[model samples]
Target: MAETSRGIGGLAFDASKRARPPELNVLIALIAIVAAFELLGRLLIGDSFLFNTRDNVDGIFNQQRLEIIILQVSIVGIIAIGVTQVIISGGIDLSSGSVVGATAMISMSFAQVALVNGQPNPKGVFLEQGWVDLPVIVPVLVGLACGLVAGLINGALVAYTKIPPFIATLGMMVTARGVARWWSKGQPISFPTESFAAIGKGLMPVVIFVTLAVLFMVILRYTRYGKYCYAIGSNEQAARISGINVEHHKILVYSIAGVLAAVAALVLSSKNLTAQAGMGVMYELDAIAMAVIGGTSLSGGRGSIVGTMLGALIFGVIISGFTFLRIDAYYQEMIKGVIIVAAVVLDVYRQRVRSRG
Candidate 1:
């Protein structure tokens, strides 16, 4: 009986030592940042800032400001979700931002409604009324299809041609931006069908973002594909040797990323009732920053969607906080750059420590 009790105690000790809790450190940092911003808003800028008015504690709970933050971040958050997956698979995608722009422009062309019943709408960019009054599904499908093709090309270049992810995605980035500009000749496309506009109306982006997030969380937690992402990210050669079809998986991951970017594009264009060729400029960097800030390692093999979500929230809060503080827009950009660098440095430090342990 003594021996058995000793063995049990030893086993329990070993288990405790081996188990590492989920990285709550990022969450703590995020909370601290928010609190700090809130305090600063209250003490420094007072009521002059955008979201930082000090009528009372109740006024601090501004629904409009909260909704604006969520709305602003929702589309970027969706793209960040996809970017997180790619980063976890030890890859980077610079083209996603341009992809959003290109997809938005092209899909809007298909989603345009006719202003004149008989004659072509002079205000419309596309002369031919091919799919006028088509179901909302048409534009959505068009956007997804564009994304699928782009993702396939990106994946092929990286996985089969042995192109570096950076170079391949950079090339795609330029190409996608050029496509967006050339498609509409630098003109903004407008007049989407009411149904199409409805897709992004109200809190729809938030709803879609939340729903997709939940679905992806389940998939990443329970699916074989998610397991393989970690395996490849941790060690690609080993994953290949394990017969995991690394190439196919890479394609799938990139495709999913593309699809998500396309969805973001659709929502953005629909909400604005117009699609500009430059709509998604710099969004890729923001998405990557969100992933990195959320504790996703750029070195790969370790991350969580929850972390990405929190990171998005942190980003929204910071931006809103800055506006609340009545800071100059240029200063906000500077602050964002500094924050991103800090996040990357912290990620590297954590990686080194984990490796040593």
Candidate 2:
């Protein structure tokens, strides 16, 4: 039937339209930068920058450097996945890093082992309450609970109370950090159970990050929540007019972001085998940078989890490249700032292109 044929054709066009602005741009950028670094490596030291030519490490690539880059990016990338959703929904979360710190301190309290090296845990602050050496699930649950509560509070302020997201999350950032420090009078918590430590050991962090990214990517592309998120971000008033529950949706978004931050904390504290008040310093910034660089619009309504993943890789490579070149840490920070601004500018330009097109 001609009518059926036309309908099928229309559907195909719609699908393609939705997937417009492929990740080719970001992917190309990634490849180009890696090439630049490779060229630089040859010029600077006559060594391979992206490949392993030495006997100290395994694989054709520099396995040690590769692992370091992946492990470091994986932790922050987890947080970025949640932040990507928040930004896509036309909101921002400034409290993720503090949430990570707070969640780490709180959860590790429950994860502490009864004995450390055959001795009672010297660092167990909750031993007096018999909270030591709990099952691995206990600490994980505690961390998620902390995140849920923080998210609820943030949602209440931004949704029902109509407070600005920036201010509400900012207030939470300070409050959460203070709670982290006050949890045990500024003492670091250590001596976690073997099971808890195993969660982030070796390449596990990268595995977790990649898994979560894939799951969320599917959610964003195929679910009602994803559609509503984009609708709200594209135009809140329009979404509300169409009967979407804007306030409740925002609450859910912030809450999910909180949970991801907590998850990041669990992995981070596990990797370090300690929970300190100073953990996750500036993590929120790094997560935001990852999302922004991956081509997520701060203004909202346009982004993909895949793009964020690539952005995270770019971030890791740049950091690793800088270290490879022996660039100063402080200078790296400055360059990072510039790159963030450039990404946002590019985002704006893309938006203009869409509007004009």
- How far residue 297's Cα lies from its native spot in candidate 1, in Å, is 0.7
lDDT of 1 by residue, 130-249 (tens): 567668988999999988888888888889998889899999999999999999789898888889999899999999998888888888879998998888888999999999999999
The lDDT of each candidate is 0.86, 0.90
> TM-scores for all candidates?
0.91, 0.93
lDDT of 2 by residue, 200-244 (tens): 899999999999999999999999999988999999999999999
Task: Please identify model 1 stretches exceeding 4 Å from their true place.
Answer: 1-23, 47-60, 116-120
Specify the poorest-scoring 10-residue window by lDDT in model 1: 12-21
- Model 2 lDDT, full chain set: 0.90
Q: Pick the candidate with the highest lDDT.
A: 2
